[model samples]
Target: MANVKFDHITVRYGSHTVLQDFSLDVESGKIVCLVGPSGCGKTTLVRALLGLNKPETGVITVGERCLFDAKKHVNVPAEKRNIGIVFQDYAVWPHMTVLENVSYPLKKQRRPKEEIRERVMHALEQVHMTEYARHLPNQLSGGQQQRVAIARALVVDSDVLVMDEPITNLDAKLREEMLLEIRMIQKRLNATILYITHDQQSALQLCDKMAIMQQDGTLCQYGTDEEIILHPANRFTFEFIGVSNFIPLRQAGSGLALDCGELIPYTGEVPPQAENGGFDLGVRPNDIVFDPASPLKARVDSRVFLGSEYNYFLSLGQKQIRVQQSMLDARTRGVAKEGETVGISFLNTRFYPTQKGEQTP
Candidate 1:
């Protein structure tokens, strides 16, 4: 319903700076997941948008409305911003019934009782919680309580919504259910949502676009899940978004080599740029394949059948790398026993500078 933008935003806490020149755009009527490691300023960004934390410098906007512009000296009050937020705790009043909780916002605005009832039921129906409107928070299941919180946000008729780790407290099964519920509700409402979380799995499943922030509070990369997974902007994006194995690289003779114990020659085509040292070969677990003819070898430390796939822990010199095989692949290639020596090769391999804090090639 509205596009949210943070332009050149910088937030500081006393002597320490939390974010510097941070910028992000959430397209109208789309769910953008802002994901990062803990304490990466995801919540701080949320606070700034909600008018709870004032940024040291920047402009915050909802569609055409200028919420905050430091140079312009315009900062809208939190309640007047008309932005809905579903907090992590669900924060439903324990004493209030579901109907009461959903209608609280409208009641605060002092809408007519008839109009409040009409809108309250409509919001409850949107979340499929109309049947339990009279039930107290304790009487409803975790998912139901979460629905109540969402309905409360919707009751305000805010076009943009911010969901801050809304499903983290639920069990895995319920988390999945709530995620689906949220997605369906978002689509039905055509709501512009900024979903914040540290769980990459959920972020991958729920987001139309994903934004990855590093530990230092800088946004590393932002794109669709496929773009971030298959074409990472740098080493940090590759290592953070998915399971990654990084092996130090060295210049071996005429060709590049992987330092997996012995200097196993890498026959894969290398970019002309990697002729020098200080690069690490990065590969995903699924990309590591078993090739009997390949010269690279690793000892199988263990094999686990995890229902859908077989996981292999392999020792390539002193370091270990994990390989995942589909059930069909396992049947076709046959399972390798523990302590068995097998030839391995990397597919879709990437090279990154091994220096810490260095993101790019």
Candidate 2:
């Protein structure tokens, strides 16, 4: 398997710049997810990788082959790049049967019919779509059609697989099933996959490495799932990747004070980019506990009893926050009713710069 590299890539349309000086590397045989808000250039970057959207500057390489380089004036055609892409819409032709769809690429390359049949069937087996090889696209379910799409992409035997919102069309349960199936197939083939999605949960669960892009077309942060989750680089990262509470802060002696007048002891590693010697306290809902002795108080506004836990929406002053508690805890200590008061304490927290959009102090 070959690694994909983007070096100082930039793309623009007329006066609007889509990506600026973006550089990232997807390691060989690794799953990397590119996630961000809508219109953050994730799709544009993918298109550039596939040679569909040519960058105005910089270079792109898959494995050892340089596909695009502004200095060298080299731009390879998309078809010649040998990159397989599974699009969000499945892109399956309505008139074609599964076997025909899977073998279309090979047929276009003038691959021998016997070899095409062997590879197409093997690809179908990988996606568990062998039984539906003769079925037309309209005859299959959404998930089955998606499997056929995957089979088509795999039949090319590309080292790098690019998936663009491959599961958005499926129901929640079906999405989960496809996620697992895709992960398994990827591992079995050891294909380096670059998956793009607006779904943070799927990105977190599926990718070994995660990259977050901002609305301004800049890569905000990129690292392993654990690194990004536990140590977000900025306020945007904290708020975007997962559910987070942003508590306003004030200077308090050597440490910072919360809006609710709770003293947070100073730590050496204050987050970069906070203003006025202030930082925003960042904590996940699950880390916010119900502490009777805690000074912070909030009114429960709503409660959602998920199968394994209860998510409580609480109002602290005018700001709202969510807290999750295990069902076992709820049974042992009855959950606070809506409109009831509860004490709040943070089990863990991260500090972000008080100012939004600032990457560093």
Q: Which is the leading candidate under lDDT? A: 1
Off by over 4 Å in 1: 252-256, 261-263, 356-361
Each model's lDDT: 0.90, 0.87
Quote the positional error of residue 75 for candidate 2 in Å. Answer: 1.3
lDDT measured at residue 132 in model 2 versus the true structure, 0 to 100? 92
Candidate 2 worst ten-residue window by lDDT: 260-269
CA error at residue 257 for candidate 1, angstroms: 3.7
Strongest candidate by TM-score? 1
Residue-level lDDT of model 1, residues 1-361, one tens digit each, is 8999999999999978889999999999899999999999999999999999899899999999999999999999998989889999657899999999999999999999999999999999999999999999999999899999999998998969999999899999999999999999999999999999999999998989999999999999999999999999988889989899888788777667777667767777666677764688888999988889988889999999999998999999877999998888888878888999999877788988778774233
Compose the digit string of candidate 2's lDDT tens values, residues 1-361: 7999999999998899999999999999899999999988988999999999889999999999999999999999999998889999657998999999999999999999999999999999999998998899899988899989999999998868999999898999899989999899988998899999989999988998998999998888999999898888887888998888877766667565556434433333345554345667788998887877777778999999999999999988766888999877788867888999988777787776567663232
